[model samples]
Target: MSGILAGKRILVTGVITDASIGFHVAKFAQEEGAEVILTGFGRLSLVERIAKRLPKPAPVIELDVQNQEQLDGLEGKIREYLGDDASLDGVVHSIAFGPQGAFNFLEASWEDVSTAVHVSAYSLKSLTTACLPLMEERGGSVVGLTFDAQFAWPKYDWMGVAKAALESTSRYLARDLGAKNIRCNLIAAGPVKSMAARSIPGFEELADVWKHRAPIGWELSDAEPAARGVVGLLSDWFPKTTGEIVHVDGGVHMMGA
Candidate 1:
């Protein structure tokens, strides 16, 4: 059968490795017929190596979300990559980083905590807004990856605060962009054993909690479903949905743990 996202042009970030959730999103988006673009931090060669694995190879663009100059150049960069006439159909804000300090709350420094907020939270606003010019031409969806914003988790610490801020930021973006028929939403995903998750001090402990607490049961290292949720939201199906937080945590957020 055919797919839902044919011919759509989408940009996805935060793919550090094949284990990263962003990788699955890019893989599936291409399978569903979308033209995928990728943004990478640190090393371009690493991203270039991984790019060969996607359904259709994508160009690796350098875009450290925290870099103002890089952010400012995004629209032009994208246009240059996709040609001037091809406007963006969707954007994935699957970007975040916090260092070790952000995971220990009481032990975390202001510098580290602030870094968490800037990279994990504020960068979403930066990225989405940078892509706004392309999206505005015909309306589009902005999907961000998030964790539960309702409560703090043990060892999740400052990253939790950043997530809360991210959720609020997404809603604000949705509100501002609604007039243009653009949508902004988040996928509050379960813990997956990605490179980013490995940075957390007690990720295994948190994963154990999910394995037990989630009614449907959650996996420590599964990202496929989360990727599917992102692709679906990016598609044309959820036209009226904006400022929404869709929990893809295997029903864990619903029950008391």
Candidate 2:
């Protein structure tokens, strides 16, 4: 297939390593002819190294979503890199984080839960609005990565709460941005062996359930399909679709048996 995203300029956040889901999105976005820029939190060297793995090495910008200054200055920073006249075609919000103990509800503290909510959930709103200046008037798509948190999962704990909030945030964004022709959606992906997942206690057990329940079967290591789903939503193909949750979970979210 020819590139569905040709001439599109996209900003992708949360690229920490080659194993990152955002990394795959950036790589594939370039392959599909989109001009892609990346954002990293704290670890600039790590994101720089990961940027080398993309089809074309993309410039990495510093964006700690939790930091108000970073959020406030994102549009100008991105414009400086992409050129002052450039407008964004899409945004991939792959940023999320949770304290280790938050993965264990029984051991999680209020502070930790609030941190997770702020980082994993609220950051989507922050980052999206920060980049809205680049997307405003022109219209574009916003794709966020999420796990299925509508239902509970072992070891997912407060991160699950964060994901639920993330899902809700996407919908509200979709509603408000719809009149402007900006689409907001999310990919409810299955568990994959990413750096963040490794931090969760007993992630292996959660992986095992998908193997048995997913109709199309699920692999913990594969990220390509998930990346494709994200790009599709960001493409013109889903023009009328907003506030929707697209599942890239191998049909697991739909099955009851």
Candidate 3:
């Protein structure tokens, strides 16, 4: 192992299956020499089972970002898992979800829209703050995933908006945490066929576009490429970079017509 992340302790969220981008990140992080912990979103048992499949067994803890109590007690829980002296070297926020109503543009109510933003966007701040105590002293990196929200992707209405907000939130976090030496960035990935993607109604809008436009082309079934980008950002290679969106969309973002 090159051990690019040797001696680093990282937190990875949103792993429901081996196909999840978080799964890939955790897998690669381990292969590259990092001790990782995972957050279970309302299903610790399922996540625990999945964690066993990783290169090394990682501890999975319950964490629903919307729950204030869980967020508040995260540090102590993590410390208990990683040890008192364990200071996180990086965090991967692959968490994002939108209620069904929010998938429709005009049909989405403020209630639905807010839920999307809160889960997909606001959680970035919430999750990061939960780890701030462990991160602030030694400083680390925070990396999240996003489906490019620049345009109105069909059936991806409110969720798209939430991602844009997520992008902005990373920038603000980078600005504020820079002095503390904490870097914040995001990976704007192409359409991936993860468990989350299967839940979305019209995810094909992206797959269709990628097939017709992407210069380098994209493989919806393959998340390792995008996953690699996130792990790289979590490593020491991107020490001086923050607030940037690393696009892993196979040149699709660069094409207009």
Q: Give the TM-score of candidate 2.
A: 0.97
**Which residue runs does candidate 2 get wrong by more than 4 Å?**
none
Candidate 2: tens digits of C-alpha lDDT, residues 34-149: 99999988879989988988888899889888899988998898889888998999999998888887887888899899999999999889988998889997899999999988
Candidate 3 lDDT by residue in tens digits, 34-63: 999999987679899999999999999899
Residue clash pairs of candidate 2: none
**Can you write out model 1's per-residue Cα lDDT over 1-257, one digit (the tens) per residue?**
26899889999998889988999999999999899999999978998899989878998889988789999998888889899876999999898888887788788899999999999999988998899888887999999999997897888889999999999999999999999889999999999999888888888877887867888877767899899999999999999999999999989888863
| Candidate 1 Cα misplacement greater than 4 A, ranges | none
- Write down the TM-score of every candidate: 0.97, 0.97, 0.98
Worst 10 residues of 3 by lDDT: 198-207
* Highest lDDT model number: 3
Please identify model 3 stretches exceeding 4 Å from their true place.
none
